[model samples]
Target: MSTTERPRILVVGGGYVGLYAARRILKKMRYGEATVTVVDPRSYMTYQPFLPEAAAGSISPRHVVVPLRRVLPKAEVLTGRVTTINQDRKVATIAPLVGEAYELPFDYLVIAMGAVSRTFPIPGLAENGIGMKGVEEAIGLRNHVLEQLDKADSTTDEDVRRKALTFVFVGGGFAGAETIGEVEDMARDAAKYYNNVKREDMRFLLVDVADKILPEVGPKLGAYGKEHLEGRGVEVYLKTGMDSCVDGHVVLNNGLEVDSNTIVWTAGVKPNPALSRFGLPLGPRGHVDTGTTLQVQGTDYIWAAGDNAQVPDLVGRKNGNENAWCPPNAQHALRQAKILGDNVVSGMRGFPQKEYSHANKGAVAGLGLHKGVAMIVMGKMKIKLKGRLAWYMHRAYHGMAMPTFNRKIRVFADWTLAMFLKREVVSLGAMENPREEFYEAAKPAPAPAAPAGAGDKPKAKAS
Candidate 1:
């Protein structure tokens, strides 16, 4: 096909929305009708919900990600980031991992560049706090937590042992609560193998500035989750903020001070600030403004979804809410992706686009092993569950929601094996710096002081 005849669809970001939307659009388009190109910093899209399980060794870290190239074999997958978008010229400047940036012209664009961890100016947060945004962070947290356990067990100093054993998590949202719970469970199980360490010797503290936790599951379930976490010996501090966490020394606004080796920051996320440079209209919170149809406001060829777009909430609007927008979560992202894909195809064909609308079904959260909380919405009734039943529901929902069938089967297999076997409590901290020993071994030996006399003779021979 001639370049002039072929239409190009450039997708910026190979994340949840970008991957699914591109796949849908490719499946619907006829051969040689349009070219689909996906650009992202990473080559794979991470399944974030399973991160906690991965951290706890319930699932493999590699299994929680889908390779964009393998999944979108028919489309061109570019491992780069679109640094700038010139809507007027219909061109984008892609900055690849290597080499220089280049301009890529496109007939249409999809901005699915997802959000980043929202952090504050808290002291030492940048240096000490570990985030839970990706699979790497989850794996790192697991190894770090286990290494801390080893340190505590081997140390004779009471203060050092206490600091190593103390785990502080800041954030009560799904990421914060679930991660702390999973890691704490792993730490407890790991302690069983250590003679010097016990579960009771470790201190797990969860702090949130909000008055309650898991607000998505409603008040009753949120309260239950807080109670359940507290019952597990986790110090739950609500309506309290951290003033400083410099050098692992955490000082809370509630007059509580502790020295902890592990500090996890999962407080919240902000939309990708790169959108500001894209020349698109962004919301007050720095998200792309979109209508119910998931189309960028005041634009015909550009569309957006996922955590980056502030799409209107049809369910809330129907309920007489004036200011209602969809929350940044996996539930809306998955659904909005399908709708956005359909709308893009229809717009390309000069057909009317469908409005993106859906009421939230419910929410589920696993609190490690056989403990959890779930709220299911059936018709107008709300069904709440806890304990083992809730945990199963959480697994079932996420297992099916996990991208492709291959991933679903793999995740299910991980769970199936876990049922018959015990969780792996071993820490492969060396995985992070696997080349350390190799680098040491590979170092060149110093020249045997080319005997000062040997160097002088070599210089005379050269002369």
Candidate 2:
């Protein structure tokens, strides 16, 4: 394998866009056309839509992520991050997970390092906040929620119990809504097993600055979602914001205050900070400015897509905004990656590039175990549904979208089994500390173990 003989295509991230784009490009190209290399900090690409279920014990967190190495067997997958890109020299500085950072030269580049959780300067958020973006966070949240039950059961102090039982969720988008709903369901089920805890004992608070939640769904469906959540004893605080959560004391802008230990922050996501670091032309929100052809503005060989690219949405119109840009969501990201992959190939082969346009199919969200809201747009007709049917729709849509059939079947099996079995509410918080059991067993004995059959005296010698 000589370097001179291979034309290299370097992908910066191994997320949804990066993995799918690389797979599509490799599938289209000839055997020896080019070498595709993907760099990412994580070894697997998580199907983020299942994160809520993963957190709520609906699906195993391990089944929500697909291993990059197993999926992209032909492509060279490097576990690393692209810290810097030298577009002029066609090289990128990659910091490997285990080794020193090195420069990797490529003939072409694909920027798909997806977005991160958008956070505010609210006090105590950095240390106390739990995000719902990836599998690790989802699993951590599941443990945290269950561990809270354990704390409440063991503690006699009212303040500690109240703080442990109260859960505060910021933001009302899909992440925040779905997460709080699933967690509430889990807590309700978990209470049945606890001696002191009851479903009424726990408090679920959802806060959003906007007047409504689930903005992806229309206003009517959003209202239905709010009603469903409120019916489940969830406290919905809209048109308000959190002033501070300093040391777990939450003060709302609407003159409400509460003390809670668990604060899950799912406010929103901003474009990847890595985009701005690349010195590319950025849109107002710091997303890379790309033409409809999916090529970075003013660059022939460089391309971008997914959440990092501000692509034009040709379907909608507005008075002041010209060519409404696509919202950063899974539906758009999945579609954009396909076109972006093809356009990159077209550029490499000197073929004509086509514009990318997609009419949104609509949005769906699961509110709890058997409740949800969905609005499907079909030929100018809007279909709205709620309750168990909508919940099935949400699961059906994302179940098929869970990438590999292996994972899809596993997730479906999880749901199928849930029909007959009660949900698992026990928290394995020790999972985070793999060696904790060993440490406990290895603890120094309060006093050396007495010799077998010894009764308040030293054991006699065998002699």
Candidates in order: C-alpha RMSD to true structure:
3.6, 5.4
Model 2 agreement with the true structure over 260-337: per-residue lDDT tens digits? 989999999998887777889999988989888888999888888888888877666433568698888888888888
The candidate that achieves the highest lDDT relative to the unseen native structure: 1
C-alpha lDDT of all candidate models, in order: 0.92, 0.89
TM of each candidate vs. truth: 0.95, 0.93
User: Candidate 1 clashing pairs?
Assistant: none
Superposed on all Cα atoms, model 1 deviates from the true structure by an RMSD in Å of 3.6
- Model 2, residue pairs in steric clash: none
Clashes of each: 0, 0
After TM-score superposition, the amount by which residue 198's alpha carbon in candidate 1 deviates from its true location, in angstroms, is 0.4
Report the C-alpha lDDT of model 1 over 350-390, residue by residue, as the tens digit. Answer: 99989988888899999999999999999799999988999
Model 2, position 102, has a per-residue lDDT of: 89
Candidate 2 yields a Cα-based lDDT of: 0.89
Q: Which regions in candidate 1 have their CA more than 4 angstroms from the true location?
A: 1-5, 446-463
